[model samples]
Target: MTEATVGEFTTRASSINRALDQIGDKWCLLIIQEVLWGINSFNEMMAAMGVSRGVLSNRLKWLQEVGCLRREEGVAGSHRPRYHLTSKSIALYDCAMMAITWERDWYQTPALDRVELVHLPCAKPFVAQLRCACCDALVCLRDVSYQPGPGATRDVREKKVRRRSSIAITEVRSEHALYRNLINVVGDRWTSNLIALSFHGLTRFEQFHQELPVATNILSDRLKLLVEEGVLEQVVYQQRPLRYEYHLTEKGQGLFPWFLTLLQWGDTWCDPQGRGKPMQVTHNPCGEQLQAQVHCSECHGVLKAHEVRFTLDGEDMNP
Candidate 1:
């Protein structure tokens, strides 16, 4: 295997990294979002996303390879094949909904407000809430901690140098899709890790550097990207040299649940030994251990994969 691909295979055994590697790119998440919205055919997805046909084709192939989606041949004489979400991708609905909730609260815009999700069983407009699966209490940053899991690997020296790809988001139009915008903000590992650290009260550049061990240039690039995306704002803390600290904006803070959900998933699945969770979470309000769980807005019942249905423009789509 190529050196870079080898590095990815070894490091991405961690569930969170695997998840990000699969769906965290600028186009992958957008493609999944579009598929969920019922844009299935290649032509439809290409038109809706305004993405180059080559990029779209590549992402679709990757998603299918990863078992998140599948393609079915078109009827008898048709040339187009329809893309459908597999159970794996369907399970990501909670994550996407949590993202939308965050956007609704902190990144409000006219275009965003036009899209809405209604729980078919509830028949009322509502937002997703993250509750502790064990005790049914809300979860927060203070409630969690982490350690190495079964899949954890000690740091290794690279056998070869890898080139960095240029950031693609800069070329995307400002008026592009909201999910695409969100992807630009936190699509990369360093940026997402920095945002998660911000929730743990890390702000200064030095603090992020110490916790992450990322290269100076890479860390700087991610911080600048976050600032430009408005997820983080820089405040001057030292005047003489104009040194600054990175602080999470409302938009960044609102992403807590999304990251928290990812953490919970990693802690559960990545640790095979049952030795212990990589992270332990406690619901402060209830003073009990926690796991992030999605619930129905109206009934307050657990939102299981099979129990829910979807609607697009008031038309029911089978889940």
Candidate 2:
């Protein structure tokens, strides 16, 4: 379908959309990850992420402006200031865990394999798992429902949507970086938005275009990329004229936890109008509003940043 042929449809300026608007770029996410790993200085992030100095500086300022990061005084004699995660960004820990879980499930990430996530409460290395806050049952894509909430309102699409960066996250030089594949999929705003919409049961091309309203070519390209990455599979839904519908593969559904955690974080930190959450997610099994919690697979305890230790090569890394 052509962009002009597609009809205008109302798209909610949901918390997730707002959230993506702030940190959806590859450079922005890489910068955040670097800071999370305690790589704080401008030079450090630039070198570690293999990002241009201009881009790194811009993303750092943007992150600080969005409240995801804050600038702090340099230590001792260092003249360069440090960037620290705000409470808003620290809350992204669960989302990060979910991303790691999905990455490990789909790819043989050497960096992630060498690192162990130890649940201090359990004192055992554990994989991250998502469970519903209502009944503690595991959350699956099929067992969830979406409903419009108080803040449901149309987003004003820019007449000229800013084009996303073409640079791949895999191009980043950080061998210690986790979630390279996940970042490649979601680092672009359009790709990430499509993934989020899939969780709401959007399947057809027309349905996706209505919610996203990007140029048709851009939409098509992202869908094609998703298919190539094994996150989506195109199913023949109509025999005539070769019409198809896109459905999430098992790999795609595995991303539900990451998006779920991101949604919750956005609800908490990205509501500019305080209109309340734009969407209400219900856990079908428990019949209660879905509250996502990332926990240890071994002990089933909710994870806390301070209570988890990351070990690399048998040495404990910083919390």
Candidate 3:
């Protein structure tokens, strides 16, 4: 089905097959991951993805048509076109990275070394992180709070969603958000922002409310879902009357990179503040100011989003 048709599936009256379309197929998401990882050229993607030439071509064409990847003529040579992430698809780096990190964890990989984003200002290895524009503080996935924004929806069952704990951020480990570990969880507006705030360490229930005036019902649902998924677990905070606080399990904390990747994309294009330029990320350890820069895994050097190229490694790569 067409993407426009597929979109209706996620909303009310959407069918199960339509839902799959919304998430896209293995080819689409994999192509997305390769671009974010700095594989920009047609050959480079074919090499890395290792899909059949027919499959690769189809997937690439589909992605290009769907507004995810843009085809650009290479400057150096007269050859096949190169693909770059459009602003729209670049915004999905969160989902892409989340997919990659999840795959790395569960799938067998010969190498486990991480490609870190070093803060240019301090020469420190700074991974992407969320910081409050107001307080200028580091936000961990576990510490932030959530309230709905303009795009909030009541798709899930309506009710006053409540937190299982008093505090929203915790050190405990849980396994909820990573169960399927796709980008669908924080796909909505407030969900990502809420989770981002917690990463910045704003976890108290009141703080979540103070920072965000989301409907009580929506917050309750998101919180419950997070709890069920093990992203957050209720902790007994008070003894006499019995109280609890929401803390990020280790499983949740590892998602920091994935969330930061998304925030960076959003801050880049979605933000009204000069395209969110002049964005600053600080080093959690040194407290020194920082910014994230990406690189290619094979090269171990900084990579331009559109500069890196791929080859099929002697295999067909068309989808």
Candidate 4:
């Protein structure tokens, strides 16, 4: 899609989509991960991510423009400047933690298994759990409902004829990369909205289009991308005219926690005036209002931003 088209769609008040548009590309998240790991220099990022220098440069520039990252001068007369995560980007720790949790649970591979996260306070390898902030109950997909918010707009424009990019972002892959793969699957706003809608029981093309206010062309492209990524499986519901329904595969369902984290974050930070959080979640099993919270699986204590540290294959990263 053209830049104008992307801007048109993202103009809507959906905080999740807006957030995705800013930092949802394969290279963006990987860059953030590198910075979080203390690999901040441009040369260091290029060497570690194996991306073209041009791509790295573009991604970094976009990230800085969005205020997710900032550049600082090097020490003394050093040539290599450093990029640091702003508070805005640092707050994404929950999202990244949830992604890693989902990757470990549903997409475990030899490469993923080699990396581990340790909760320093707990002194043990830990998993992240999404619990209700309201009642400390587990939050699931079936517990939430949404409506239009104050920022909601009915500005869906007529479809514009456009050519697809010659190189689709979804077709790009990184070597044994977790965050890149996750972003590749749900990189764009439309694709992320489609996945969120699928969790709401909207499966068919018309259903997704109705709820998302996205162009049919954009919706179709996202659906095809999801199916290609094995997150959504397209099944024929009717043999005549080849009617099909998209269903979440096991891998897709595993993304529930990540989405929940995003929703909670949006509600807390993005909405502010209670306008954007049009959804209310309830813990179905416990019959209480839900606000997802991330906690350490080992100690069952709340996972605060300052309490966690990283380790790579049993070595402390001190990150």
Model 4 residue 51 CA deviation (Å) reads 2.1
- For residues 71-178, could you state the per-residue lDDT of candidate 4 as single tens digits? 998888897889999988888888988888877776645555776777778888798888887777665676665556555653333233334434454344433355
Q: Give the TM-score of candidate 4.
A: 0.83
- For each candidate, what is the lDDT? 0.68, 0.85, 0.48, 0.72
Candidate 2 stretches greater than 4 Å from native: 1-10, 157-166
TM-score-based ranking, best first?
2, 4, 1, 3
The residue pairs in collision within model 4 are none
- Candidate 1, residues 148-222, lDDT tens digits: the string is 554455323222222433536535443325455567677666787688778768899998887666678888988
CA lDDT for candidate 1 = 0.68
Instruction: Give the top-scoring candidate (lDDT).
Output: 2
Span of 10 residues, lowest total lDDT, candidate 2: 1-10
Counting only residues 3 or more apart in sequence or on different chains, how many pairs clash (N, Cα, C under 3 Å) in candidate 2? 0
TM-score of each: 0.77, 0.93, 0.47, 0.83
Clashes of each: 0, 0, 39, 0
Better of 3 and 4 by TM-score: 4
- For residue 31, model 4's alpha carbon misses the true position, in angstroms, by 1.1
Cα error, residue 53 of model 1, in Å, equals 1.9
